[model samples]
Target: ASYSVRRVVKKSKRRYGRKLESQFQHGGSRSLWQGLRTITDYRTPSSRMVNADASLADELNARFKAADNHANGASGTNSVHAERAGEVNTFTTSEHDVRRAFKRVNTR
Candidate 1:
């Protein structure tokens, strides 16, 4: 039946997973790397690998900025207003004042 077939497939997958775990535990460094690559599906970069430098980063930033500008151009709702913070008058307190305040506390 289809139910029995599904159970058999699940059991086989579990057995394969256990086999991979055992390989990770008992295998050498090479096998460990192989197992990791297998699990992650890691692939070597092509010859046209991009060097990560400031110029490439700036280009990406500019592209993203242009895209954001284009997307938000139609909707003129991105204005942010800055508010001035209330000024506080400074008051000087001495160590004697701090000690006297601490002494009034009950030490229970």
Candidate 2:
């Protein structure tokens, strides 16, 4: 009786030779450069630059708020989650606004 758990092993060794720009510089992490294209049909202004922090904060806050609402009186964890959710939401929007203002100042 040979019951063996088959496991995937990468026998071929190859170094990943690539130059990666961090989200702060290039405005995106996780090799998702392809997703940077604007959704609008019209071409984006040549001068427009993406602000990574604003984008990140907006995303993080929304998710936290949603999670806290779902916690719903389970225990102290729920209360903590709700409090943190509000904090995250506030921080996200505040940072986003500041980032937007900063970009406007720089671009003009």
Candidate 3:
């Protein structure tokens, strides 16, 4: 059941991502700005609206930073060290494993 739900979610995400990409390609900056505005205009759980005068980019950045700081504090790790560790880990990809995965996809 969980697998089926995951598959539906993945499909929806891919479809939406493609639609956004197409919109950005054809509509350019206007489409991107509209999407951001729509997302940020959503009402909070308390039914309060986001301040119209506030810069959405700054607001989002501050919120994300706070969330990141909280997560780091909970995990007992400094953000700088965590970020550096992530950068180091990205280089450890296995080409053989990746190729095998793609082969399985082709078989499907």
Candidate 4:
């Protein structure tokens, strides 16, 4: 299994090193290195685990990308707090009129 991971990292580092190489590189702290090793093990590939890891990674990546797309959209950027901020602009109805109308309708 050791060689299984070495081979995968070696190959992937060549193409997409920026995203994953630092994960395998030596860390500043011993504990951090140990944590990376554990993750490396879970991500380590085998004939069996390779397909499963790829499937799960693809699904998770798709979800993140979809969320990213939405966040970058104009509609998604207006959060609930921001939407309610300028909503009090005086319109045809006043603050009290809308509530009174609702009460009149409900009373009937």
Candidate 5:
């Protein structure tokens, strides 16, 4: 779940970064403040001026909780069968494993 959340966030940031880069490259704003304002003042369809981070966090939390409930509601026998069906369907990595992998890569 954490991995899924992190992957979503990373993709979102990359997409937003590309958007900002395109805006700066083509928008032809004369000043840094103008460019910043263009980026900051832009509104999406569901844009809100306040508590955006909190709202996004709440939404993601709800989504994750729903997914957890759905997964947990699976019958034990069905879940066992599902687990045996494929290794790719399982989340095999732990936080410790990620940390150790990072450490090894950094040391090298």
Candidate 6:
């Protein structure tokens, strides 16, 4: 039974290694990244975790509200006023400009 288990494990490892190599060879950079992630068993960390109570949410809300208040205080300069002072309030575009922009883009 132990010999069988070892054989199975060896076979699985060989198969996985082959697959990873193939991914790196023919898959380009994206496939290479995927292969690396697979090798490392990589997973994106969750942005938020489940909470048994609402205290976490309440704390986050309070923090965000405090930050908002601080940003809006008299010591903080309004972005809109700064933009107005820079004299870039309006945006203008033309069909020719659009065509030129599109022409500059690579189709591939």
TM-score of each: 0.34, 0.21, 0.33, 0.21, 0.29, 0.35
After aligning candidate 4 to the native by TM-score, how far in Å is the CA of 57 from where it should be? 0.2
List lDDT for all candidates, in order. Answer: 0.74, 0.51, 0.75, 0.66, 0.71, 0.78
Candidate 4: segments with Cα more than 4 A from true spot: 1-52, 74-108
Lowest summed lDDT over 10 consecutive residues: which window, candidate 2?
8-17
What is the lDDT, from 0 to 100, of the residue 87 in candidate 6? 77
Candidate 1 regions off by >4 Å? 49-108
Error of 2 at 44 (Å): 37
Better model by TM-score: candidate 5 vs candidate 6 = 6
- Candidate 6, RMSD to the unseen true structure: 13.0
Question: Judged by TM-score relative to the true structure, which candidate is superior, 2 or 3?
Answer: 3
Q: Give the TM-score of candidate 6.
A: 0.35
lDDT tens readout by residue for model 2, 19-81:
333443575564444333332243547754465668778888877766665667453356665
**Superposed model 3: Cα runs more than 4 Å off:** 40-108
Off by over 4 Å in 5: 28-108
Candidate 5 lDDT over 43-87, as tens digits, reads: 447746565678788899877766765787853334655666876
Q: Give the C-alpha miss distance for residue 85 in model 3, angstroms.
A: 53
The C-alpha stretches of model 2 lying farther than 4 A from their native spots are 1-51, 73-108
lDDT of 1: 0.74
Candidate achieving higher TM-score, 3 or 5: 3
